[model samples]
Target chain A: MVTSAAPRHAAPPVHAGPARMTATPPPIPTLLDSDVVRPAPPASRAIKAQVENFSFFYSTVQALADVSLPFRERAITALIGPSGCGKTTLLRCFNRMHDLYPGNRYVGRILLHPDNLNIVAREVDPISLRMRISMVFQKPNPFPKSIFENVAYGLRLRGIRSRSELEGRIQVALEDAALWGEVKDRLRKPAYDLSGGQQQRLCIARALANEPEVLLLDEPTSALDPIATSRIEDLIVELKERVTIAIVTHNMQQAARISDYTAFMYLGKLIEYGATAEVFQNPKCKETEDYVTGRFG
Target chain B: MSTILSDNPVSGGIAGSRNGGLLPPLRSRSLLGRLAERFIESGLLLAAAFSVLITGGIVFVLVSESLPFFRHVSAREFLTDRLWTPMFADPHHGIMPLVAGTLTTTAVALLVAMPVGTLIAVWLSEFAPSRLREVLKPALELLAAVPTVVYGYFAVDFVTPALQAFIPDLPTFNMLGPGIVMGVMIIPYVSSLSEDAIRAVPMLLREGSYALGAGKFTTAMRVVYPAAFSGIASAYVLAISRAVGETMIVAIAAGQQPNLSFNPLDPAATITAFIVQVSLGDLPHGSIGYQSIFAAGVTLFVMTLGFNIIGAVMRRRYRQAY
Candidate 1:
């Protein structure tokens, strides 16, 4: 299943076995050479969004430095990095979430495909741009409202006031988020009454209500239990057929289980980017290999 | 329960000792210490009861004084009568005109305060820079600290003249001047309380709205305002009650004449203004005029109490539990 997703990649090298992963292996001198090459990704996938030479800053401090990568259409791309490594920062740049705060700055172009609009450009209004690229936060932060209203919030923002239209879209979004079965009978109940897992799905339903092309998840299941984590992982894998997804996760197992493509970032640089199997099993960079092999975060 | 108690070795030993000749410790207290503790407890209880006691006393006085006025003037007449001319030869004790005066001024005040105050609150919460918020919040609060009488004078000397320019025939002492000035006086209350409520709305909710492509205005009005509905509504209701009970402002600027006119340009007397008007005069203690103050006081008390009840109900009804 993993190999078919990126058929151009050769078979996984035998030396890349987990048992061979070492903490004290001598650094390869060939890797230090500029001729170090990364495996090419399959050419079948279309680009959904591109971050070109993107640098991000919070007030005076720079968060991401010259980071560039392409998100494949209808594919799940997981951003893996330690805390404060610009993984979440780069994810937020896709939908311009940083524009809400005053001092945070996006210093490079993030081009959304088809029309090729730079998300951080002067002409694009962050408010309207968000409709096409919605985001679910780190914690399941559903509005303090009913289950139905929580899912319907984004639709209401778009001025869809008809009862039938709202009910229809809300049903679809909830069904898509796989929360309709448990919550359909008590849609009027407050979202807070739901467990942590249900609330996270409700948030996903909220983002899906806008019919966004790309969905960003920032450490979505960090607050959930193991059962909820696997449920969300399964939901992400299924959702990739309909929407392009970029998730920032600290959990390497979650990234490996769900994402088709993976980007490893360290400090502020894009350390590695390729098909998920290649990045995880046959990492090109020493930092990527070490981090993926569990030598260090 | 006995088996559970016996499960603890320490308690079982104590129980065994109790069954023997040993008695529990007396925890002997000095007489002075006992007295002091009792005295402090009584003092605390008295302090807790003081407010209820004062409220009961006020109700007793009001009802006792108002009974005599109701004897001459029927309860129906006092409640339903259009005129309120107790000082006149005929001595009409109708309070509707005073009520109309209070309602008119409160309506006018709310008209000015509600929108302006809510907008100010939104700006302070969502838009104001940190340094600007630090400066603006205390400055807005200073408006509330100004004495009502000072506000009354400002109404008469400044607001009345400024309004008179546009409204040429506007009375020198009209409900509009005091009502507008009272609105200004209570702006800080509405703005500060509502600002606190709006600010208390979780940042996550606002971020959720923004992520859904909602503009700042949309988020503030649709999400933040509704999320903080109970607090904002209660703030407005409390402001309205303050406007209704405002004495010095209406007493000075709103004329003593109990005109039952709805037009704000005309001079009118609020229930509070009438109380102030009657108290300033040298009437005998048991006279109808003297007793009429308590009747009006009772009316003002009931009206303000109703507002408080409504505000409390609103605070609970729409409270968005995070």
Candidate 2:
């Protein structure tokens, strides 16, 4: 029997091992080729976050259902679909932003395997989880502060108070985000002085300052112009070498251009996932092909 | 007014409303509109000019009345001396006592108002749910609508009794009771202003802070709070000025005894309370006794105006929101 697993609170293991996955595709059209020749990358062998029968609920309504997939370690993974396809919700689940809202929850098995453990345990400290998986938002959301303080905000949270230490971390993080040269001299200036694209890069730098192992971007360049978008795309390419990256983007071309691995999600289901090139060029699932080729969401 | 009179494109410019780094010559329209426009525009301008006229009249009245007091008591002595006793046969009054008392009460009141009001504002804006937040915000603002005299009554009866229990030797009428109650009255003003400011912080900033592993408290303080500080501070300064000028609470609850003392447990009078004490019943108009009240009013006006101006400057210096 095919396993119908789910993502939820409580240790997902101990009750199971070597689980089966679901076959439901998302709101996006699955490509015909994704069914036949999904090019699973060698890096997927080192899966970091594994979901089995992963289902989500906003109070009572289930947003996602029976999603079984492994997020590959140390690669840029893209979650692509039309709006309300549960991509952003799925991303939020990885760090539990839903905890702030009342009665909202996730059910089933989501496993983060550094210690090879399940992540959905009731005892999981969400703060630490968030520290490991830092997120940059769709809009450039800098604090009302100097550029230096904006980047130092995360480090200050972990109790690094020394100015010199904060400065060095700020420099390294900005360099990591590919924003050092543009903003290095104007560290004392207010963050609002920067252009829309620069502010987004500054946010990326801010997230990296905490030395997070994974970076999650939810449409990080959606508010930016074309020039800023390209700058961020370049930054994302450099960043993949240092830390794992996951992005949820509406722009499929952007997903195709920058991602190492791509998951096509439509109607709250992950329809097809494989190599970025494969998912775009020759998707096995017919729905993915239609969505990719601009037939329909 | 100029808008109706001037069909000239120069209306959009102090210099010129240049776009894309290129200057265009002023565009004009309808010569007929320009002809009758001056008379109509002048009438509107004159209407607008009345506000300035009213302000100038008040200032002229104040200066004319105050000129005699300055000849008898230099501005230096009136400002620096702490004791005020113009009612005494010898008449050795000083404005310092009133000024000091006003500052002390206002400062202490701010200590109370700023924290309580800011916390309530934060709760109203960021933490509370939509339905509850909607209900709570207006309810908090209703605190401001209550008559100051009612606050004075509450302070006299409820607040003074409570204080007497703690201090054992508390006065029946003291600045402490009135100042605290006055702080409570100003809470809505602070909260309303701060709530608007905090709500103005974009949702993205809060979401970004949350994503960085910061708790709600951390996000509110480090991110949201600082972003809204300019507006919140203006609210606080306004509250201070209100506290200094507040008459009913202090006049009825805090005994009108002008002295250079800050011990809130002891009876003391602010400028407003002193003015109220003097103004009660006719005290021979044009006498030094009656004129003293105007002197206090002028000082009160100047103090409040200074606070307003300084608050404005600081707000402009740090203009930022995100």
Candidate 3:
């Protein structure tokens, strides 16, 4: 699956022989190399959104500095980085989540394709932009409402008032989030009654109810147990057939397992971007290689 | 263990050596320290018990004083009788008129308080800038600090005349004036408490709504409001109790006559107002008029208690709901 997703490039050599027999190890990559070589995505895939030289600030402190990356249509793009490396900051910028606070500013353009709307433009309404690009938070944040109402919330925001319409859409969203089978009989129960994993799926169902074009997940399974995390991973992999996905995760194995493409960020900059297999096995930049190999964060 | 011995030389040398190099006992060694701890615990327990004792004392007095009044007037007449003319030459002992007056004023006050207070709370919690919130919160609390007597006069002298300009038949002494003024007085309580509740709701929930394309008003109404419903409900109950027990405002503005009418424009005396009137008059100690106030007092206590019980049940239900 990994090799199939990689774009055409000079494949890195694999060490088939035992490393101990060589009596010496390969040279470790150093951070002095400045150039970042981002292997292009396969030609068959189209770009869903392009973030161009985007910089973000929380008051006077810059969180993301002149970072550019692309999310391919109907594909999973995972962002992996250490804490405070601006991966989550860049993910939040896709839906303009920063607009909720005061003294936060966006510089440069994040252009949504097809119609080519710049999401970060001051004149663009965050509400409308958010409607097109939905987000699942780092922690599950289901509203203090019923299981049914939790999924129905976003649908209701779009002015879908008919009972039948709401029910049908909510069922579809819940099913898509892989939670309908467990919760079908208890639609009226409070959302808080659900276990942690189920509640996280309910949040995903809530986001999916809007039928957003792009879905952003910010460590959506970090708070879940292993079984729940695996279930969510399977659901995310399944979901990419319909919606474009951008995820931020600290887990390197998770990025390799689930993502079609991966972007490694460090110190508020994009260190490397390529197909998941290429980035993991053949990182183009020293920092990216160091981060991917767990040499240093 | 060695680090601990090094850190504390006295305990390592004396206490440890006394225990044959074992760590010293976890319990305090000083008798004075143990005694001081016991003293503090007893002092705290006594402080807690004192409030409970006072409540028991008040209940005992109300029941005891009410027994004498109930002896003179049958329970049936005291409850069903419409006239409460205790001071009349041929006095009637019915409590219905006073109950009606209390209910009418309370309903009017709640009508003015609940929605207005909730709106103010939502604005402060969700939309107000930090500087404006800091300034407005203290100013709103200042309204609560104003003397009830001053509000009473304000209701009678300012509010009544201003209301009369619109409705010419409105009486100078009517429940409407005091009811509105009392609602204004209780606004600070409701808004402050409700704002605290709304603000206490986790920001994560609000972000969930906003992430789904919800505007500020939508998120405030659907998400923040329901999340804070229990706290807001408690604020409503407190405002209801305050309006029910308010004495000066109703006594000064609403006339002292007992009229069994629910109309806010009607001149009537609430239970609290009647209690104040009877307390001021030179009625004999054991006279029926003097005993009548106890009956009114007990009735007020039961009504407020019912509201509080209902508020508690609702709070529990909502606290679990989320």
Highest DockQ: give the candidate number.
3
> Which 10 successive residues of model 2 chain B have the least lDDT summed?
B12-21
Please give the ranking of all candidate structures by lDDT, highest first, separated by commas. Answer: 3, 1, 2
lDDT of 3 at A237: 80
Sliding window of 10 residues with minimal summed lDDT for model 1 chain A:
A1-10
The DockQ figures for the candidates are 0.51, 0.50, 0.55
lDDT (Cα, tens digit) per residue for candidate 3, span B1-322: 7666545545545665778867754443478987999999999999999999999999999999989899989999998988999999999999999999999999988989888899999999899998999999999989878999999999999999999999999998999999999999999889999999999898888889999999999999999999999999999999999999999999999999999999999999999999999999999999888999999999999999999999999999898333
Cα lDDT of model 1 by residue, A1-297, tens digit: 112222122212321234232444434422212211223336559998999999999999999999999998988899997778999989888878888778988788999998899998968988889999999998888877889888888898888999999999999999999999999899999888899999999999999999999999999988887777767776877798899999998877667656778999999899999887667766789898877666677
| Residue-level error in angstroms, candidate 3, position B136 | 1.1
Residue A38 of model 2 has an lDDT of 21
For the predicted complex of model 1, DockQ is 0.51
lDDT of each: 0.85, 0.80, 0.87
A14-89 per-residue lDDT for model 2 (tens digits): 2122221124443454332222222334645477788788888999988998888777766789998777889998
For model 3, how does the per-residue alpha-carbon lDDT over A52-71 read when each residue is reduced to its tens digit?
99999999999999998888
Off by over 4 Å in 1: A1-44, A144-152, A156-164, A182-195, A279-297, B1-57, B64-74, B161-169
Query: What TM-score does prediction 1 earn?
Result: 0.81
Report how far off residue B299 is in candidate 2 (Å).
1.2
Give residue A45's lDDT in candidate 3 (0 to 100).
89
Place model 2 in a CAPRI quality band. medium
iRMSD (1 decimal) for each model:
1.5, 1.3, 1.9
